[model samples]
Each structure stands twice: as C-alpha cells, then as structure tokens.
Target chain A: MINCKALTKKYGNFVAVNELTFQVQAGEVLGFLGPNGAGKTTTMRILAGFLSPTAGKASVCGFDVETQSTEAKRKIGYLPEGAPSYPEMTSRSFLEFIADSRKISISNRQRRLEEVHELLQLGTVLDQKIDTLSKGFRRRVGLAQAILHDPEVLILDEPTDGLDPNQKHEVRRLINRMSERKIIIISTHLLEEVDAVCNRAIIISDGKILADDSPKNLESKSKFHNAVSVKLLNSMNLNIVDSAINSLPEVASTRIDENNNSLIAFPTKGKTPLEAITKLGAAEGWDFSELHVESGRLDEVFRSITGGTAR
Target chain B: MNGVSAVMRRELRSYFSTPLAYVFIVIFLVLSGWFTFNFGNFYNGGQASLAPFFNYHPWLYLFLVPALSMRLWAEERKTGTIELLLTLPLEMWESVTGKFLASWLFTSMALFLTFPIWITVNYLGDPDNGVILAAYMGSLLMAGGFLAVGSFISATTNNQVIAFILTVVVCFVFLLAGFQPMLSPLVGWVPQTIIDSIASLSFLTHFSSISKGVIDLRDIVYFALLISTFLYANVLVLNMKRGE
Candidate 1:
C-alpha cells in the first residue's frame, strides 16, 4: 500500500500541496483530477521521490519516502509529466542503462528488455534516438522505462495526454492490464478518463482535495444522476409533454432540447422515475424514442465538486 | 557500484554521440602541443624531461576542463532529464560520483593521448620515466579537482554558459592563489600564517609539488579532499535546485 499523511509541499510562499492524506492499495487505480497547478503533479512528484515535501510524511510499501528514499524509490516506477529523457540516446541504449541502474540480473535483462519493446511496440524505433521519435512513441518509451523493473507502485503523470485516440485506448488497456496487481495513480484533465480507467477519483482544487470517492458514487452527486432522458420525434406539443411529466411529484423538473428534439426529466430525490416516464409516454401516446436514465455525468459532477474550476 | 557504472557508461556514451567530444579532444591536443613547443620551447630546452610539456598542463586544463564539465548537470537540468535520473533507486552521491568520474576519465583519456610526446621525450635521451608517470598522475588529479568545481557550478544553473564562466572564474582563483606575484601583494598586510594557509589551498601549490616528481601523500590528499568537497556541495545544491 501507498500511504500519505498530511502531505504538503511549498514553493517559497506558495503552498502547492496542502495537508493532503490518502491511501492506495494494490489493485487500485487512483485518478488524480484537478485544474492546472492544482497540486496533482506536485503530489505525484512527492510520492515519486522527485521533490521533498515541506511537512507531513509519505511512504510506499511501509518505506518512508524521506527516510528510506532508496528503498521507497526501488518499489516505485514514475513517469514524469512530460516524459523527459536523454534525447541523445537510442531507445535500446536508454533501456539498457535503466536496467543496469536497476541491477536486474544479466540473465533476464535481455528478456525483460524484449518484453517491454514488444509490449510498447517499439521494435521499429528501438535503434532510433528518442529525439527522433513521435510524441506518442516518446511517451511509450517513457512508459517502457517506468515498467522495466516491474515495480510495485506506479506513478504516472498525464500518461495519455498527447496520444491519438487509438494510442490512448491502447495505453488505457495497458493500464487496466496492470491495475489488477499494482498500485497506480494517473493524473489527467480528461474527465472521461476517470470513468474509463480510474477505480477511485480524487477531485482537488487549489492544492486541497475537495472530493474523493469511487467514480460511481461521485457521479451520484451530479444533478443528472438517475434523470430520465427521452428523444422526441417532433417538437410538436413539447411544452404539454414537459408540463405533464413535470406534474408528477417524483419528477422535479423537465428540460427540452429543441435542437435534438429531446426532453429530460429530473427526479425529485433518490427516486427511479424512468418507469413512471415510460408509462406517461405510453398513456399520452407521445412520439418519442430512445428513452433512458443517465446514471450520472462525471463532467457535471467534476464541475460541481470543483466549483466551476474544472479546466 | 553498479549504479555508478551505469550512470558513468551512459554519460560517456552521451559525450561520444555528439561532435563535442571529438572537437574538445582535438582542441585539447592542439593547444597542449602548441604550448609545449612554441611557448615552452620543448625542442630547445636542453633537457630530456617532459618538464616543458608537463609545465603547460595547468594552463591547458584551465579552459579545457571547465569546457568538459560545464554540461554535466546544466544540460540535464535544461532538458529536464535530471528528474528521471535523481528519482532512480540509487544514492545521490552515486550519481554525482558517476558523472564526475566519467568526465575525469574523459579528461584522462585526452591527456594520455598526448603519449607521443612522452614517447618523443624518451626517444631523445635517458629520462626517468617514473617522474613522468607521477607528473601524469598529478595532472589527472588536478583535472579532477577542476572537474569537481565545474560539476557543482553546473548544478547551480540550467544555463551552460553561466556554469562554464563561473567555473572558469573559480578555478582561476584556485590556480592563482599560490602564484608568487599574486601572493606578494598581501605580504605586508596579511599575517605569515594566513598567507601560508591560503597558499596551501592553491591548485598550483599542490600540483606543482606532485609534478616535480614527488608523489607526496599530502598533495594526493589535497586533490582528493578538493574533489570530494566540491562534489558534496554538488549533491547539496542539486537536492535544492530540482532542475530549476
């Protein structure tokens, strides 16, 4: 497990991370969500042992980050924000050097290198300088270095930030493949990413965590949670249909989207109004299609929890 | 130890990957040869000793060593690779020492490549090869001292030119501290003990003794201490800088 107690970091008078506490266990993929400079990167850096915290303590697998730095670092793999590396080195040489620094036994070093190369699909560019590779390739190279040692804890900052859609999918799949046995923390501004990969999400703002919960539970905080949405075939009698649906006590309000010929009814409380809406549509003989209830909107929840600070 | 060698090997490979290493070695060789022949009068100095050759090393290294060490940390900082490097599972000192040793070895390699002069000196007349070897060792140690200072300065800034200039200025002070002309000005006001102590800290004071064919443990200790002192400072500064 990775643990942090009141972890904080200050740059002169600016507090980058403020008294944050959290714990992550194996098989947990934690998503760090925040606006830029919201201390997402700062928190990750402190955990990765790149920057020292001003106060508080952090540990990985029971090893204190500050006191047993090498031991703590040995159990972690970190991919920094930009995936910076030696531009002069070829992918093969750089990985070899990392393996040597890690002191992987020579007998299996080649095997591990080959595995990473194939996993990242870096065979074509293994001999090319990192500077010559594309942004996606460079990012993959950084990922390869991070997982070369198969560390227990993985801290990745914006792991899929600049990738194409396909590349992003591949990277997310890879993360999911590894999430079953390791502790992973990925920071991203992509709200859907939290829904896609993160088991739990922490929404922070101004260096303070505002909300922390599983994605589903967090999404429940959204006003759209459990709201029934239906696509109308025509805008004819839209106001009548909206008013009739809004008349029900369980249905708090209704919104009509003329652009898409759609109308949505929000629940008054923790109520499932989808069946009631379907019965009303049938009894009223309304022209509608694609009637469904939204579990929640993560973007709406993120915006609400972060108080319009979501970037 | 493995960590040190891993870093060292990567550092050495980086130097060779660019034209900088070749250009530096060529310049180092040309300048040393010019100083030894045109200025030191190696051909006309009625002596079989490589004294003329060894005498010019301190001056040659004054510029070359700083040039070699300037990019050690500054480039890493500029490129943002220092974060990846420092976060690796190794002691901070291991990285510092690895980088220092790689540059020191590079300088040593360039110095040894001047072996034709050593061969020429031996070819001309009977000369004590033992003294020459000691002089080479002294020169290598002095270069190490210069490199250590450069490494610390490099960690202080992301600008390589600034690192190079500051290292040159600091190494110059160490080089001239024991010069008789520079020291004579302080003869009246400074106490004799203070004057001697300052002179003892000079690169010239320690390196000259070793280059004179005397392998004194005191001089060796001086270079070792100087190297470690600056390298330790490098670690401390790097810890605070964090690629700033």
Candidate 2:
C-alpha cells in the first residue's frame, strides 16, 4: 500500500532520514521502530505528503507523493505526532469539518462520523470543546478525524504518546481492529505497543532501516541465548555447583547466587542447557524450588539491533 | 463545494470558535462608529454621502486587517497544524483564496455594520444612496487590499506579533505613497508619471476615487489584481516551505 525508495530528508546539512527504502503491503500493520529523532516521523511526514524528501521518491497507494500529492493524500489518513487538533472546536464539529473538506457525501458522512465516534469512544465528549478535553480525549478526537472518511491507509505517528495505560490499551485494540481492512503504519518509541499491535516491525536507526521482520522472528534471532532462573530451597556449596555445571559439555558458563541459592547458566553448542540442568540436579541431589525459561523479549531484540536504549 | 469555498467556510467557522472573531468585530464597529460621530464630524461633512464613514476606513483597516490576517498562517505554524493542512488534497491556491475571502468577508460584515451612519445621513439630509453604495464598495476593496498584504506578511513567519508588525509596516508604506505632505519632498525631482504610479498604488488614491461614486475600471482592476497577486505569492510561499 505504501512504498518508499531511497527516501532521504535533509534539513540543510543535517539528514533526518537517509536513503531508506521499504514497502508495506495491503492490510499489513507495519511498526516503524526507532529511537527519538531516528527519522521515523520525518519518513512518515514525507509519506503523508506533509514534508518533501530532500532526495528520492515515495508513493502511497500507487500515487507518487511529490507529483500526485493530492491523490496520495486522499488515500491516507494521517494522525500526526502529538495528535494536534483545533482546540476551539468540538469533537463533532471538527470531524464534520474534516468530512466536508474531504468532500464526503452527506448520507455517508453521518454514518462515518458515527463510526469514528463509536470506534474512538468519543460519543460523550463529542459536544465538548477539544480544549476542555484531556490529552487522551484530544488524541482520540484527532484519531476520529483521521478515520472519519476511512482512507485506504492510516499513517499514525506516535498514536498513543501521552495516554494512560488503559487508554493506550484501548487505542491499541482499536488499531488492531482497524488493521483488518486498512494498511496501518505506526511510529512509536514504545516497544510494547508494537508488540501488542503490530505483526511486522521495522527498526530504524540513524535514518537507516536496521531490521525488518515479524516480531517473533526478530525475538528469536536476537535471543539465541536463553536465560533460565532457578531458586533453591537450601544452601548449596557454590564451588561444587559451579564445578559440576562447568564440567558438563552443554554448559558454557555458570554463575551462582549463593544468597538466593540460584543458578544462572548459559548453554554450550550442540547441546541444550536443559539437559545439563537436569543432569546436574540429578547427580548433585540438590533441592530446587523454582525453574522457569522465557524466550527473548522485544526490548532485548530492539536494543541489540538498534544498538541503543529505546527512547 | 469548490476548494476556495470549503476553506472559507472552515475559516469562518474558526473565527466564531474563539474570542478572536467577536473581539475584532466589536473593536472595528466601536472605533468606526466613534470616528464617524466625533472625528469625522458626520453632522457637518456638509454633504449627502458616506464621506465621513469611508474616510476613516483606510486607517481602521490599517489596524483591523492585520489583527484578522496575522493568525492566518502564523498560528497554524505555531501549533504545528500547518503540516496537516498543507498536506490536504486541496491545491495551495484554493486554501489561500478560501482563507483570504473569509477574512475579507468578515471585514466587510464589520464595515457594513456602519450602515446606520448611512441611514442617519439619509434621515437628516439629501444623501445620494448610489454614492453611499459606491463608497461601501471602495471601502471593501481597500480592505481587501490591506488583507491581501496582511496575508502575504503572515505567511512569512510563525509569530503572530511579527506578522502583525510586518503587515502594518507594509500597509504604512502603501498609505504613505499618496500622503501629500509625506511624498511632497520627492515631487520636484521625480517625473509626474512615476509620481502618478506611486500615488496610484496608494490605498487613498483608488479608494478615495471610488468613494466619490466613480467605479473606474482601473481602480476596480487594481484591487482585484492586487489581491490575486498577493494570494498567488502566498501559495508560492506555502509550496516553497513544504517542498523544502
């Protein structure tokens, strides 16, 4: 639905987004993952036809952004960063104004307006001026305006930036439900949001697309090492524990938390750590209380890939 | 249905959405009415025309038009909503024309509210309604000219104060071009054609002519061309900034 070819945005000598190319398919939810100022917003702005790229080309729904901007703009709904809205306008009036500007028919306008209001849960606040609404409510109002005409693609830049936890979840749910029909690309610093809403994640850093894959695949690739946590019921001699585990061929390294009576182990090649763990437990006759294994988390994958803290 | 009308409708709605619209109207009416009664000596202009009312318009619009147009683009930039607006499907000229017309129409409404002065003159004297209508047209044209200049100045910056100040400076230059005392020093050396051109560009020259019940094609074309030029420039400015 959206395609970018070596798109680069430069503000004088500073490059905001550099030579980036990617494509999002129809009905795909692409998460634009980046640290702050990593050119996610810049790239999204260019695609939304707000800012022109200093070099290269971008298109939305088959129309070039620079040449066919109006046609491209007509095909997309953009929720800009901070979800800016006319503070003096009521939610209903704002949506109606957008609908009119988009030239939606009166019969369909009412139905679409109703759909947005219900979808964003803006019914109660529809009559209230946007200035009087909270940040979350105001953001929802922006979302309502974006989706009122139901464009083919939705480009949301930090859709849930300043929302409470519950509101964020609500927005995530709405995005997921909307994703069934429209191609949605969201740029956010919050990794959990991408995990919850996006099936495909694109990690960008320094204006470059560092990684692009499914969330599960990214997790597995970055998380080749598994961390197993264990707590023992009784005191265990540290040297004996380490000697036993280190001697095992499957065990690469062993660290013992004598205070908590736990063993943290890394696996060796061509063998599973579980085998070593089971063998050590059987031979040492050690009393164990808890053991749990977790797959690599999104934060680890993101940090390892982006080479910086997720800001 | 047209792009210009769509933008105009939204702009007009926005004016009422805040205190800005009401504030400008009240200030415009009170000032114009006060000037008409006390300063212009409406009781003794000794003629049957809206002379006193039309006379103060150039000065009134000097301040009022800036106040109205300063926020046209500056506020959009300040709030970052300009990004959303410029990306809309409408052409830049359509939005500019729409916004300019809305402000001009609102200014005309404020100007028209002084009709009671025309009524009072007709009630008390043998006033020519045709001349009065012509004066209103002239005042509107002059107001449009000032608004166009203001719109152009507003597009230059994101600060409303800067927009207002710059627009006033530009309008002042236009006003000074025709002031007899202000331009008298240069009259000796400059050729009459150049002097006439300078005078013709002044608000007082064309507007005063129209106020005398004369709708000269030159003056009418002057106002329309001036407004269109500035609006075209406004669109270019938006495109240039967006294209960057």
Best by DockQ: 2
Deviation of model 1 at A40, angstroms: 1.2
Count of backbone clashes, every candidate in sequence: 0, 0
lDDT tens digits by residue: candidate 2, B149-236: 9998898899999999999989988877887876788798999898878877887888888999998999999999989999989988
Q: Write the per-residue lDDT of candidate 1 for residues A218-303, one digit (tens) a residue.
A: 98987889999988876557778888999987799888887887888999998879989888888988988678989989888888
lDDT of 1 by residue, B1-244 (tens): 3999999999999999989889999999999989899989888988898888888888888898889899999999899898899889989999999999999999988998999999898899988898999999999999999999999999899999999999999999899998887789899999999998888889987888898899999999999999999999999998876422
**lDDT of each residue in A1-311, candidate 2, tens digit only:** 78899999998888889999999998799999988889999999999988888999999999999999989988989999988887787888878778877888878988888888888888899999988999999989888878877889999999998999999999999899889889999998898888899989999988999999988878766434465555677765656766777777777777788888787666664456775676678777977687765455788778877786532
The numbered model that scores best in lDDT is: 1
- Model 1 docking grade: medium
How does each model score on lDDT?
0.91, 0.85
